[model samples]
Target chain A: MSEYIISLAGLTKKYGALTAVDRLDLSIRKGEVFGLLGPNGAGKSTTILMMLGLTEPTSGSVQVCGIDATMHPVEVKRKAGYLPDEVGFYEHRSGLENLLYTARLNRIPVQEATERAYLLLKRVGLYEVAHKKTRTYSRGMRQRLGLADVLIKNPEVIILDEPTLGIDPRGVREFLDLIVQLSREEKITVLLSSHHLHQVQQVCDRVGIFVGGRLLAEGDIPTLSEKLFAGEPYIIEAGVQPLPDTARLQTVLQDIEGIRSIQFSEGLFRIGCQRDLTSAIAGAIVRSGLALTHLQRKTYGLDDIYNRYFEGGPVYEQTA
Target chain B: MIFITATLKEDLSMNRLLNIVALLKAPPAATGRAPHPFRAIVDKEVSDHLRSWRFNILLVLILLTCFGSLYISVTNIGKAVKPDDPDGAFFFLKLFTASDGTLPPFHVLIGFLGPLLGISLGFDAINSEQNGGTLSRIMAQPIHRDYLINGKFVASLIVISVLFFALGFLVMGLGLIIIGVPPTAGEFLRIIFFILLNILYVAFWLNLSILFSVLLRQAATSALAGIAVWLFFTIFYQIIIKLVAKALMPSEMASGQAVLHYQELILNLFRIVPSQLFSDATTTLLMPSVRSLGPLTMEQVYGAIPSPLPLGQSLLIVWPQLTGLIASTVVCFALSYFSFMKREIRPR
Candidate 1:
């Protein structure tokens, strides 16, 4: 097995009577994009801080790149880069200057730091206004600059707390695309913490949904759905053309052995089934000669999982 | 000139020279561990303080009053009461501690303004980092958490010492130009101690302000807390001490020794206020003929001596005040360090 780059064992953090992170165990493999998904105050940031050794865990350990993070936080930090939820830069400093300061902190030489700073600013599409004070830049530019700050040390693992927070939709897309590219091309393991699942869904290889300081489920999208929704119906949603009558569609779907339930409206049919029997259902619809314009599986995203898990419903545990 | 000009870009401020050397020589790549991060933090914080309006406004305030004090001292020193008076020995430094008529002396001004300077510099130091959202980002770097606090402390101390020394030397320089009297070696040593006293006294306030900054969330709240503490010590503290002393010891029916004891008790109580410590240290250091901070009994002063104490003897006498200022500073710093370490950096 490939070694896990980031590993936590029984990690717990408590404040007086309140447990912020409780009895947590997680592992993120090298070069994998792992998202820690949780709502506000659900301890996602606390977990991230513990993993980086910024916040000491009440019990247990964090191992980053084979180093004990708690015992050797600086060493782990040297190999890890963190972008906090709200990325702050010195307002009086130029974007390039801020990055250079981080570079110098990481002990990059002056000439080399300046060069790397310029290159990273350009990489983040902030080179045009690299010389302007950060206060003048938009929130998006400051975030991109924060990314540049983290990358200055060439960290082996990048920890981003709410990477898409407070960014415009366009900026979010650009930023996520950059993250995906960084993971793929640079082979850097990324641990992204966010309450929003759709944002992580676009880039994460695996995700851990946290509720009440407890990780409820951990897996890829399909794996999680299959496990959580096992014995529950798989849904197929379709839109039909030609002022479609519901009778024909229902009649066609009635013949399918796997079909559990079907509901048809003006042009839409929400079909619940034992499995993904879209091909069979679609074949029957075609045979009945109703023009099927669109056909897709009705998916259960993270919000549904979060709600179910939060409502004290069962979640699938990773068996192996 | 051209070659030097080219290198000037690299070392614009002598500030970053140590950082450059640290970065260039055996960077993390070679050693597999980066150099200490405090240098970078110190450099950044130093620049921030320099560009801040708080520092600029105070700089102007101090310069105006100090130069005014210098002008007054120069004019006053023109007429002398005696050729060999003890105060005449350190005529040059007298400009720093003696008032003409209207404004307070340089030492008194510093004794009052020093805490305000300290508070302004540091009251928002950490909380502003939190408010601006940079604390987490910097803490995430590959540096010890201790570096953050130590870096800020060292940087502010550097600035405080520089400001005090520059002003002290300027007043001395102006005294030289106007009065043409150079200070003796003992007088020069006394001046150095006076400036050192200012730094330690202001550093106490700086530490206190940082402590408040760590405890309070908003920058404005921390600033207010800092100023409030300053006000308490500068104004309310003495009044409260007097009231407490009066209640504790009734002088109307008390014996002479009891009154002396009461006076010493009140003076000891004043030691708690950092401004008082500063004032006591400055007066004793500047005016050597002044014997002590507390009331002296007739028996203790039976010798009737009016000689200037040596630098060592004077320091010995006021060592408690000096140590008291520094100890409080250390305690406040310790509090800030522990609070910052324990503080969970998550946003509210």
Candidate 2:
């Protein structure tokens, strides 16, 4: 069997003159959480639709669970589950009834479907509201129910488009954690498409930074940061007391051999360099007889990498 | 580009053929030893309709009108029936068409209300699912997408058929108890055929509303469109047709043949309205004396015996209108089916 559970080869989708997904070539490994990160209208939802065979690509192909989606969509749909953005349910039906309907659509027997529905609802922490009409469900509760709905299929691959949209911050965190735990426990491959960087970073094993219908960069967090900052790969900031002579400090830090750039802002010196120079910088500061109040290395998060790729400008302080 | 599109068209047609073949086979879920997904969807839609206040309200309204007209027809039955009148044999059929002029006959009430029932049932069928965000979720299931639309249409048709048949049989039973006479086999068959024709007429409107639901995005917009079409056909279309007939009326010196042709033209123009077709067909079936829906010339009626037509003769007389109704219903359904298949399920 191929290691890839979901594959899209040169997939392109165009609406009139606009290309929604431009020659997207992506393959998701089995049992891995792959995040497709992009802002709204970056063709994330369009790509997901193509993967599920709900919308045809203008060109190229998609395969899910060893079946060509375009050629045999029903079979691919049978093996894969998809949670659309803002997933909706029959409002009049209870959560259990909704899930039971899905189970019936998947052809599960009524008794077994009921048992599975209850178990999944409980697993999603929605057992208390399992019998409540879905119209009464909150945004977060609906999202959890959506997760249960996807899981009820017992699919090998789950493609979630904006799965955590409109949930509270705490709810988003819990939902992401639940997703990670579930993917780990069930060994289900998940393709989560979201514009939210931190949320994607929390659960995604690998992420593809998408922009304007194209995947700009893709890798694990560290690898992507390393690639983005190949020349000067480290960022460090230090707060010093009893400010030393400016000329003396510049000469000393410039003499450290790998300093690329440095900036003094708000009583702290931010330094960009090629390698670890914490010890060297500390030694220089002590030699100058200035107290080193605070010193630390700054790790690159997805937001930083995204800004670097999109803006191609100086890095800014991380914003939550 | 042309070559690519041609190949794509070929592929699409081939895919459609395969879809049909697969639909003939068990649904994907059926492979897991479960019930057919189409049946499941049908069951869900059936229950939804049965529980909805809209359907219940419409049902109650129709029941009231049906029984009200039946009462009026029964009260006037003895006065209308003369001992020497040959139509005395058709006392049962009059239960539907007879009226005291306060309310219209049962068949007329249905003509006005049947379209409303169909419109209400189907106007929001697709658009509401799409708007509610349930459409994409359901489309992602293992069943063919066509199952959703087909199941809805079938479920609505079933409800309409059951309700109509029940009302028809109930009316017949009531008439039998009040009059103390059983309808002859001929009258029984004619009533049955009339009920079937009513279902067909309602199906025409149901499909038209479904087509609107597929074409329009908002449930409200589709509902309005369905109502607009119904209003035009029921009210404004007749007014316009009457104006045209008056403007084109034959001169005073025109020959009888000319008058006959002019009248036939007017009748044909009126038949364009679905309700007119339905009323004509039901009238011929329910009253069996309607020898011709077209204008009859003097020569045609000069030596003709005044007698109630046999069922076969009545059917033959209304065959054109019947075929027209059936054709239009099928056409509406086909349009909705194709457009729905071609539509994007994503909400904008």
Candidate 3:
């Protein structure tokens, strides 16, 4: 079998003039946590839907677990569990009842389904409210229930669309940590789609930066940064006590080896360079009779990468 | 792009072959998997309906209509029957058709309430799941998408059938206890046929509401659309047809054949209404004396003996109406099925 548990090749979905997913080619490895990070309406959900065969691609192929998704959707669905952005349950039924219904749909035996439902509920930290109606539960609890619901099928892959949307910060953290724990424990491939970059950055082993129906970049965090900032890799920031003049600081930082550009704005300095020049820049600042209050090398995060590609940078055009 | 197009063509042909192969495979029962996925859905829907307040209220209303009409029929049995009249011997069938001036007959009450019950049961069948954000979840399950729709239709049909049969038998039992006489075999068969007709009539509305549910996004909007169609067919359609017929009526100088043709034309136009078709079918089944639904000339009725027709003859007379009802129901269900399968599935 191929390494990929989910493979999408030239998958495109169009609604009249709007191309929701445009010639997308993505493949996720077995037991790997892959994040599809993009802004809202960036075709992440559409891509996930096609992977599970919930929505057919206008043109192209989707193979999940080595089965053609469009031709054999039921087989694909059997091996893949999906959690929608705002997952909801039957309001009148208890949380356990809701999960039981899903288990039955998967044709699990009554006794085994009930045992698994309870076990999953406890794992997701919803055991207390297992017997309560879902309507009375909060949004965070509902999301946790959704997590357990996805797990009930024992699927090979889990596709989550905006899983952390509208949850509290603490809930989001706990949810991400739980996801990481689950994936590691079960060796299950997870394709999580979200516009929340930092949340996905926390759990995903690899991420694909998507925008406008195209994947601009795909790799682990460090590799992605290296790709976007190929020419000048290191980014250093320094804060000066009693604020130095912009021109003076610029001249001093420019003289250092490997320093490409220096910009002093908002009482600090932002320096882009080829390599780590923290020591060199600090030495230059102190020798120039200026007290360096704060100095740290900037680590490229998903947010920074997103901004560089979208806000204003040549990376967007280059990647396109 | 050319490569993509080539691959796509190959994929389409492959999918067609796979579909044929799947069709040739063993059916679900023979496959011997845990309970069929379809059964689970149907079971869930059945319980949901049984527990819902909307269905309970409609059930109560239907029970009230049954008892109210029975009271009318029982109280007026003396006037409705004459000892010397053989045609009036059908006392059990009269229980459904007999009406006091204050209240309509049992069949007319069913005609009004049946559509409401069907609309209530099915108007929100799809859109409610969609709006509640549960549709995508269920769609993700390992089953054919059509199972959801089919299960809903079947569940509602089963519920309607059971309720109608129970009410029919209940009325018969009560009439038997009060009158101290069991209905003859013909009367019993006629009652069974009438209950079957009621179920079919309601099924037509249920399919209609389900179609609306598939086409519209909001439950309230679909409900209102179903109600609007129901109102039009039950009330305004006949009025409009009558007005059109009046304007095109033959003058007094016209031939007897022309007048007869005009009346037949008006009758045909009126039969377009589902309730009119239902009432015609029920009257033939329940009364057995309704020999013909269309206009008959004086010559055609000149030498005819007045007698109640057998069940087979009555069925033959209403065969076209039954076909019309069944065809319309099938057409509605097919439309809903195709539209649902064609539409994209997405969270709201």
Docking quality tier of candidate 2? acceptable
Q: Candidate 2 lDDT, tens digit per residue, A1-320?
A: 49989888899999999999999888889999999998788999988888778888999999899899888889988878989887889999999999999999998877556756765776689977887999999999999999989888778888899988899999999999988987886788999999899999989999998888898888888899898888778877887888754455677676798877776767877777889998899888878778899899988888778777665666433211
Cα lDDT of model 1 by residue, A226-296, tens digit: 78777655778888766455556667677788766566645577676778898988888888777888898
lDDT of 3 by residue, A1-320 (tens): 49988888898999789998899888889999999998888898888888878788999999999999988989988879899999989999999999989988988776556666766776788877888999999999999999988888788888999999999999999998888888887787999998888998889999998988888899999999899888778878899877867677877666788877676656677788888899999999998888899898988899888897656654323210
Best by TM-score: 3
Per-prediction DockQ comes to: 0.43, 0.29, 0.28
The iRMS of the candidates, in order, is 5.7, 11.7, 11.9
| Model 1 / residue A287 / CA error / Å | 14
Q: What would the per-residue lDDT of candidate 2 be over residues B121-216, giving only the tens digit for each residue?
A: 999899889888899999988989899999999999999999999999999999999988899999999999999999999999999999999888
How much RMSD separates candidate 1 from the native structure?
6.3
In candidate 1 the C-alpha lDDT for residue A152 amounts to 78
Clashing pairs in 1: none
Q: Rank the candidates by lDDT, best first.
A: 3, 2, 1
Q: Please tell me which predicted candidate would have the highest DockQ against the true structure.
A: 1
lDDT of 3 by residue, B1-348 (tens): 234224323533667545533432312122245688899999999999999999999999999989999999889876877776545868778888887678898998998999999899999999999999999999998999999999999999999999999999999999999888799999999899999999999999999999999999999999999999999988899889979998999999999889989999999998988899999999899877778999877888899877789999999999999999999999999999999998778976
Report the Cα lDDT for residue B82, model 1.
Answer: 52
Error of 2 at B342 (Å): 1.4
TM-score for model 2?
0.90
After superposition, the stretches of candidate 2 with alpha carbons farther than 4 Å from their true spots are A238-256, A261-270, A279-294, A312-320, B1-33, B83-86
